[model samples]
Target chain A: MSENQSILVIGADPAGLQASKDIAEFGFRVVLVEKRDELGGAPIRWKYHTLAPDFVPTEKVLGPLIDFVKNNKLVIIYSSSIVDSYEQKDDYFKVRILNLKNKSVSYEKVSAIIIATGFEHFNASLDPRYGYGINPNVIGINELEIMLSNGKIVRHDGKIPKRIGFILCVGSRDKATNQWCCTVCCGISIKQAIEIKKILPDAQIYVIYMDIRTIGLWEKLYWKSMEEYHINYIRGRVGENTGQEKNYWLKEKIRLLEDLLKLCLI
Target chain B: MSENQSILVIGADPAGLQASKDIAEFGFRVVLVEKRDELGGAPIRWKYHTLAPDFVPTEKVLGPLIDFVKNNKLVIIYSSSIVDSYEQKDDYFKVRILNLKNKSVSYEKVSAIIIATGFEHFNASLDPRYGYGINPNVIGINELEIMLSNGKIVRHDGKIPKRIGFILCVGSRDKATNQWCCTVCCGISIKQAIEIKKILPDAQIYVIYMDIRTIGLWEKLYWKSMEEYHINYIRGRVGENTGQEKNYWLKEKIRLLEDLLKLCLI
Candidate 1:
């Protein structure tokens, strides 16, 4: 909370940008570093279009934060830079940042160090069963988002898909990739489903999920998607994804509740 | 539960039709009566374009219920009929239904009676201050819905409104009218806002509310309306409604949260 003291924040994404701004507002200097050339994180840089659950404009939501970070005199932003070295020197953190743009390294002693490195979307190409990279029709959620924002939500043959299928838990919540559930996926998928319906009103959307984790107040979104959007939902993970000439086929595993011991019949 | 017993369902709306069909499926004869000459309720009959929160087609939602009620042998529908009289006879009730289509009265002895008379929209005409009948621009939520469904959401002069405003808690949640929050209004308004945005992407929509009562999952609808749809929400009640040649003016009473005892500054 002093002018002399400063906080070193790594990764100038949404979290990093927001934290630096908040700390600067509290009368502390902040040095925000980003490996990328710009301050906007993967979401903005990659053009994610809209935010999940609400589907508000991504720019509108992040505009104020971006503005605050830019205008704040106490916060210094290091674009195209990475932390070269970091050492704990008693109460202070001695850190060296390498600026890729200038080809020079700078040392800074800060009172506190904060790491706000953002996350990466699971590569759908790793899972061959989904035919992500192989098939032109099959795409990851992040890719679909970028496509939607760019008005490219079409099949490989440049035609609006009559029926679009969203396979939930592509990488997350799987034994092979991530064993944890990406809680935001359900809301994101629901939001995307609504967005798709808005663009292609006649298109039928089906979501195949292990379990919809849009719990609590977010459950309303899932229900709305079902009742209002008329989205079809099947409680099972898709097994095989095959790309034909025009249509993409998804083989779903139908499991019966009564036959708990029996394997799923695809 | 037996074929000999009968259940009387008042009002042949969605609830009545579905209930009668459900009861008839359980081997009980159901007599569904409506004063209006329609099987679908006010919502269906009035043709609300899309159901709130999710924006699903209303016809798709109510189609199955209407189909079941019409096809079921045990479910007898009496359109243009009303409950004339009722009397409890031991365990059964003798009810008289007057047919509006024909000048005749029919009596039925039923084991159980269900009152499924749906709600009505608050008459905006009664509140002269809001200029319901005076101003064509200022309309009730139900009227807006009918207009939206009919593709008549344009101005009275047949021009797209660049700015549209909604005054929440119209009649239901007031001391002068019905003393209960018409909970569906919030979601309905939210849905209407989104629908309007879809049609007129450049149009600015604002909702002036005393308090947004979009509780639980319905809150997601409110958030979507705010964040995704970019609908503006002002936390206050409009006191005056003045319609000019083109623009409709709303006088809002802004209250400070700190001043609990102090009156709202209009």
Candidate 2:
């Protein structure tokens, strides 16, 4: 890692920020490329119950990274788009990026590429049973992020939902699909339940999770939410939707939880 | 709500802390009382996420409350234990409290008694799935709370566990028993995660929550934990324990989350 050598970071989420931090710490000229003007990315805006208090806004939590960028005079390309093109420049990998809004293309020399694009949600439209595309309010956790940022928790109908149900492992950890626990829904559900209670102390919240994956220091978070907050948790998987309401899904999908305790509770 | 009538408050938790400030502003004598030796109560032992950035401790967070206590000479009872209960001759609630280690009991009179003792945990033994009593290492969030106050993430084995599982909604939101969310878990969990992560960046963390409850302003903490520290949250419950590890479960109870993810990921 040479100070004169340039390093390219592909994504601009928490992972990318971390990578930039690691590389910049080694005295390398770094170029942080994000497709959005906002460097904070998903975690900054994505809606969910679980958030890290230390994970403040980009300008705040990412202060060290920003300072390193300023001190090193690193180039940041916001609103930049990248293509999977292989350019042979001195027998090295040369990636090309196009600025979508300006319609201008830029090229950069890279000594090493840190692929920290982070995870993505597979199409919810594919699973029509959830009524995602058919229902207005049937949105993923990411869509809820911006609204939550503004301290807004009400649905589009402007009604503070008395009963909120969450379906976890929606696209993750299913052998039929991309089998991986997005590893977040459980924590998000608890976080949301807590937040909802904060706003509407009387509201009822339900979390339907196949499993709650909270390990390490986070186990305490899971236990505290469950034992202290009083948010209900059912061990089960939600199935297809049945009906629709005023622009939103009137009926949530159904599925039988393998656990007898869950079935009896719900 | 009268200016001339001096108001009295008990328990310097959030409610008492808030009430003391509000009433004092109205030009009245506000006597805020705390049974504990400290002002912030359990929160002082518990690392909180919604604290000021100066790394302010729980006692310091009540700086305003403490100031009011000092300026107005608010009523404070340290090492005092509530003993005999009764009513006053003047119709106000009269109570007797014995100061521990001093071998003396004191009696006091008050116009009103605000039970701001906050909500205590239902206990770890209540949830057998967590292996609370069956296993010596499986402690509740409060146990970790004490250790965290000192700013270290140590395990029962005297070394950080490669993997620690967080089982959410243990006693509060059990679908079979209680359906109510305690409401503070998400924020507290986020705080613990960040603090633990800061101390042990090498540890693999997981938070298995039935749901996440960050509620309003605290949602920031939830997202920060998930996005920044790579704290993995799996939506699942604590399964049967049959392991014999002296730390996670026991010799015959259950094997805590596999101790590989944390090591392999980094």
lDDT of 2 by residue, B1-266 (tens): 23444455667776777777666664655545566666665555354433522335665567667666556644343334544455666645566665655757666655555566655665656556556666655656676666666666666657666666666666755556554556666556666667778878877777766556554456556667777988877654455444344334423354455331110000
| lDDT values for all models | 0.73, 0.57
Task: Assign candidate 2 its CAPRI class.
Answer: incorrect
- Where model 2 places Cα greater than 4 Å from the true spot, the runs are A1-266, B31-33, B45-56, B74-112, B133-136, B175-179, B245-266
Taking all chains together, the TM-score of candidate 2 against the true structure is 0.46
Output the TM-score of candidate 1: 0.47
Can you write out model 2's per-residue Cα lDDT over A1-266, one digit (the tens) per residue? 33677778887776887788777766676677777665555555443223642223444665565455545555454445654454766634577777767877778777777777755556676656666666665666655544456666666577665666666666664456654445555565555556656666776666666656554445566666667767777665555554333221223434322110111010
RMSD of each: 28.4, 18.7
How does each model score on TM-score? 0.47, 0.46
Q: lDDT tens digits, residues A1-266, model 1?
A: 24679999999788898898889886888999999887768778767879866778888877888888889899888889999989999889899999998989988889888899976777777777767777666776777787778865687778667777777778764568765655677778888888878888887787777656564456677778987999987656566654444333335445212100001110
How much DockQ does model 2 earn? 0.03
